[model samples]
Target: MLPAPSRPPRLRALAVAAAGLVVLTSLTGCTQIASAFNGLQQNAVSTPAPRPAVTQAVSMPYDSKFTYDGSVSLSTDVADGLEVRLDVWAADPKRTQEWAPDNDKTFGFAVNVVDHRVDEKAVLTQKRRVYMSMISITSQVSQSTIGQQQMMSPFQFSADPRTLVPSDTMRSDRGLLLNTFQGGLLVPTTTIHQLPADTYGITLQFALQVWVEGTANTDTSFQQQTVYQVLPIAIFSPTTPTQ
Candidate 1:
């Protein structure tokens, strides 16, 4: 094997100088790189949180036979708003059980959509419809010591554009009012749920969702409103009728 050639002094010195320059450059660039990373972290932390979405809740009166008559309306700055009304009545089934010999038995309630409308301003940029997609009813009953009984999706109430009809106002005006929609949601008594007895407190909750028109490329603006009413129910008891 041939002996390794010894490096020239000038070349060795030049190599040492290059190594020193690399070390110097690394040391100088470290602070700038760290500062850049820190700036990004700070900027990320300083970003503001988003605003909360719009939601409204209203309470309704209680009826032993699950009857409600009310309306809820909400307005916005952009001329897009929603209005809903319901007048429901429960029929006396006159159902009799061996346990209770009474004639004031109620089977279920009937839903009469008094009025539901969506008013919006004209948006020439995009085409849209004031769509009322769904309606839900929730029932809850509380007893003295038996805890509480709640049903999240009790009474399946469904509505759509087909269930609604254009109002007289919308017919009078042409394309000028592209955002107005009006109709009623009528639910038959067959769709309602039967009431149970021997409960301290009973409540019925109603909710509806609507899709409002928005910008062409952006997602639609959704608005939902929920309202509940207390149900005055008197439990039938042979031992104690008021119980």
Candidate 2:
């Protein structure tokens, strides 16, 4: 085995918030709703028979107005037999659009997602980090345009992993919200003009990329991997208040 780092390698964590806009208009009152698959999960790790391991699925909201809390749980296998567990959610005030002339025509969501990993056999010799690759949105119910963009890139701290001791339990986690805007609001120059007030079915796609340290002792030996997931969101216009 290659020699370990002079000092214990550090753990690296990442968080991302991605936001985009697409116009949708309701056509009919009879809505064909798709039930939110609460706790949607997929296993990409080990396929061994259940001798003592247990599997569980968590549920997330499927239908709601904009700016509400929505969550999706994740558990997947990554490079070097590492298992990752995390959750993804849309930030509160999921969408914001003001009608004031001075107000910027903007809307966004704070979709936070986190990923942590642990090697099954304690074989990790270096740090591990995961990044939010991309978030996509599409509206088939309104016949609108599709929107997708890379959330955030890995940064300096994220490139460095937290130390992992040989005898340590071997676990770490990082958090991020995927959005194009900062402070949960798009920049003044952003072209995302408004949020649709129509009832429609929308699909959101999320992707994650991971980098795992290798025991080869060379920088080139680091392993890189990616994970992808798709989720559904339902939108309904707020009811007008009685005067």
Residue 4, candidate 1: C-alpha displacement in angstroms: 99
Cα lDDT of model 1 by residue, 1-243, tens digit: 112223335334333442232222443443443343333323321122233443332233223433111111222222233222333333343221111223333232211111122223333234333334554444454333232243333222333322222222131111112232222233222322233343334445655554444433244443333334333433333543221
TM-score of each: 0.35, 0.33
- Which window of ten consecutive residues has the lowest lDDT sum in model 2? 29-38
Window of ten residues with lowest summed lDDT in model 1: 169-178
TM-score of 1: 0.35
Q: After the best TM-score superposition of candidate 1, give how far the Cα of residue 5 lies from its true spot, in angstroms.
A: 99
**C-alpha RMSD of each candidate structure in angstroms:** 31.1, 20.3
Cα lDDT computed for each candidate against the true fold:
0.31, 0.27
lDDT digits (tens) for residues 116-182 of candidate 2? 3343222223233332322232222221222322112100011111110111212234222111121
List candidate 2 segments past 4 Å from native: 1-69, 84-86, 94-193, 214-220, 239-243
Residue 147, candidate 2: Cα error in Å is: 19
